[model samples]
Target: MFLKRIVYFSRKTLHLYLQSSTMSTFTSRINMVTGNNEWIFVDDDDFDYNQELARSAFADMLHDHERNIQYEQAIIKTIQTLSKSTKKIHVLDIGTGTGLLSMMAARAFNQTINSSCSLRITACEVFQPMAKIAKKCIEKNALSHCIRVIDKRSTELDLENDLQGDRINIIVAEVFDTELIGEGALRTFSEACKHLTIDNENLRIIPARATIYVQLVQSSFLQEFHTLKNLSETNQKIKIPDGCRHLAGNTIFDLNANEIKNYIRPLSKPIPVFDFDFKSLNDKTNFTKEKILENIQCDYDGQIDAFVMWWNLDMDEQGEIQLGTIPSWCYDDKEKEENVQWREHWIHAIYYPQQPKIVKAKDQVSLYCFHDEYSLYFDVGISPFPPKSFTPTFLSRSAVAGFNNDNRRNKYIQALEKSFSNTSINRCLYIGDGLLLPLLILEMYPNIELIILQSSNIHLAHTLEEILTNSSKQLNYRIIPSLDKENIDFQTIDMILSEPFFTKSILPWDNLHFYYLIQQYHHSNIKLFPSKARIRCIALEFDNLYKIRSPVNQCCQFDLTPFDEQILQASLNVDATIEPQSLFEYSSKKPTLSSIIDLIEIDLDKISQKNKIETINLDIPFNVDGICNGIAFWIDYQLEDNIWLTTGIENENDSWVNYSKQGVHLLLKPIEIKTGMKLSINAAFDFQQGQFSFNIIS
Candidate 1:
């Protein structure tokens, strides 16, 4: 009999493995092996470090300052709204993570209510561990008397048994996901209103209503993250059969409001799709699941490649206090100033329609939005007719335009052209993910014998072959899906072109997939396009980017010191964290060579599969007055002798080129730096684990 093992890697630590009976002395060991540096064997019952880490991450929610501020203010406003009634204020905090809102409600009640009465808050959390943590947090804040922590879900609360048969006056919940309702918000709210709250018309709910909004956009950048749209010129021109609709993939990501203008071009004004009222939906049957926004006029003449969606939360009934997740471009001059608050908890979602609608300015269209119990979907059409059914076909189309790319394809073509103009190649081998490179080589070197190392995606390969057939060109090429030294005749292949992409890659350095493909044959005298690669880093001063990962010891005038302490203890035990960040969207204090440090350089011709861990420690000197938030890192690929492609820091004066992924490692807390300061930095990378760690040594 054979036993199976499951392996997991922390972002900045050793690889961990789990197997049901190690068959080694005793049940298991905890990071017990020495000098292997590759694997860490541990038992599932011994530590459960992953579960602890998840609990610690709950404190991270407090770092969303905008969310905290809005909730605090809404709690205060709700207390005021219920103050008119002679009945004692009853507030229920649903899914309370850190008891932050319950504490705020208690404090607001303490301030708003007179000496005759007191405020009571019932805090409910489904997760038992989180409930315990919240209880500790409430006790630490001295709000234990006014707030009660329940360790069960809101639906489990018994009216006659748990609440002393008291009817609640106000209900507060932050139980929303990226797709507004992904966390069963509809069901939870419906249950609360029907059973938990009072029957009075004056009953109040924090975040009284939420309105969904949508705007048509033209963005290939957004589309690339979901699916590779077949982008051949002939494919772009190919018309779909009449009445044929292809549903593109649904995309959800935390889009930065400030940097959206640089990547996406808007084609239509933002239109309000629908609004969901928590107070109005007392019965589950009364809930709405579909809505249609008809006759929306297009303001621009272009291909509607995708739809940008976001929502606004009306925290109070009067609408005096509201929180919105609109991109910076949509905000007026007043809202762009320092008065407005930004949030990471809620960001815009980009949706690709069933088919990208190509239209002229002033063209009118209707959009139908459908929602299941947990998620939302949308479809678009030129006619004002409503969709026959809520469910749309899932179609991944290959129709993409050049302008939609922001001209990245043009840059790659130029680099390829420059490389080909100098070398005379009779036989070429293509090793990359996309078909663009192969198609370009075929068009440029008409007589060259080309062999493409095709991607594992058979559909994509078939699409590429179809594209070639559609062009009506006679090209000499063979698509080889798999490669090894035994099958390939290396003696005849002279040059290799690669886009350096892999489906399994998650970080910038994962492009080493390109190196691994050709390393075995490097000594055979075959040249590679990117002959060299360098990894670079620079210290950065983020305006507010570090808050997402920063320790939230205090928020909105409340002391969450206990939660912060738990996170600190967890950090002291682990060395794993390589967080993904959009560093290009941030501004570097300086672009000088002194500010930038080249961490490691790899010779594409010499790298091997058995590479060892590399470490670097240096005392870097600061030359400017700024706050050190994190270190931004990117990769530079040397395509030819002088020409290169980089995802590193690009000059603001120059146009943007590389769209490759970059990374940022934020410090535990931001530090103020001045000129003449010596900053000690140490970093290590373990290729086996595909993890990197950065430490700021005093």
Candidate 2:
């Protein structure tokens, strides 16, 4: 019997992997062979690598592969929120597989009263084969008059061309992966917000918004599930870092996605959730330099290995895994996917835990433990009194003592030189989204290319499209976008500009969206028509496509564009802070300043959830070795250290919540500056604490 074989191609030659045991030796040349070869042997045909690459296309794999079911929920949900005016709305669909949702939107528009204007849906897909199939699907659905599929990558969707007409009122896409940035989302959403939006008019993304959440949990199904073999070697002790769980659980961001029978093990920890709306495109474009949220407290613990954030989006009311359609793309070939569920190729940050410990939960009773590739860690018990401090032994790759082997400045210079020599493009500067850090780097890289980016703006699409359509086009070379992130790109690009989040957004300025649309272009290989005009940047979005709640009022209805700061202030006044925690250290054992909880003698893969963790607490005036990357840690600091807010005389009437953090001593230094202020300050030496005291200025 002929065994089932799956075939696909990258830049290399074709690979044929058998799904079952009833297979034979793999051969590719096509020559008439005699019968009865141990395995099935057909004609031998030798094909060149270039020819093989030409033959490779993801169309068939994306369209006809019975692995995924098609869903139209995103379109339906989008239509539900639209009024007669929103009819014939311009819709951009990114990663349009089979054009199912796009077709639905077109059909709905044809039936809407506000259909006087042409209803358009721009669909983008990279794989030539898949894009062709999507067109055919659109035709079959009788949506050729409205739905247009452009088989291009998101970054390639230039705002100058594709976005030149009337701005799109909505965007729909299925660009989310485990970690939002992993699936090339950074470049996709960023461009869309910059160049594809409606001028002054409001646009929507199906599913309205997306919420990202992270939590710590325990799992033990790993060992038995993996089908262990080399018992002795596998059981040997391994070193893991503090605050790291051996088993990083696998789950889908799609709310409706299923959980397979087998689950990966993980340690339980408090979960952090961040939410964003598409209409609010500022956060995704924010850069690292000027928009820095110092000690933003991704985690509360002192020791932090990394901040791994995942994203889940609601495409439509049906919660379509792909832009509000029926769940399809998220699924795997059940018959063949017994070993894995879903995964994309990408890398994120790794901020490991600090040595020793800072603050541990004062109420916990048991110890928690886990391990990373480098060291073992544990959570010790809380203490009511002061403890002796010591130097720390860091086993993790954190910002610890000697964290950097070489000077970062020198490395930056070298990289700048290399990029200039390679690209033959000099006077280059690197810019990324941040509050204040990137600007500093600009001064350092001034001799080369100059780059400046916003920490809260998603305006790279226009600039990117200019480069793509002008320079050799490649989606990988564009600025990345996000809903909650400041900025995140897939493949590294050139200089960055101001972020869209904190900076004034494009929506406030009308008529610019259409100008951007006019500047779009398609990739060279595939000559997809309407798709080239498709705003892959804006067309493939899911947030802010539905009910738009102002960022100020997380739960309130927010339709007015350019959300008012006063509303934000009002939201802050009512938004209560949850359980607070400052820098924390979680180890299976006790945490002391300069102490290390080494999980050296532990079997990482064999680690079970039942293994209890240790915890230690701190009350007053103390220091610890370890740190936590938890939200509680940040909120606590926000409230206690006076680091989260500040006030000036001009802003005395403005009792605003400063989203900024301050120094440790300022926590309780409540200055009672009266109407008129005077100064009579003096500086004196305090030899004991090796510091000077703060004199009052009245």
Query: What would the per-residue lDDT of candidate 2 be over residues 540-560, giving only the tens digit for each residue?
Result: 011111111112111111121
TM-score of 2: 0.35
User: Which residue window of length 10 is worst by lDDT in model 1?
Assistant: 1-10
Task: Name the lDDT of candidate 2.
Answer: 0.31
The model with the greatest lDDT is 1
Report the poorest 10 consecutive residues by lDDT, candidate 2: 532-541
Per-candidate Cα RMSD to the true structure, in Å, reads 6.4, 30.9
lDDT of 1 at 356: 71
Candidate 1 C-alpha lDDT tens digits along 5-49: 101333233333437543322222222111122434333332345
CA lDDT, candidate 1, residue 458: 62
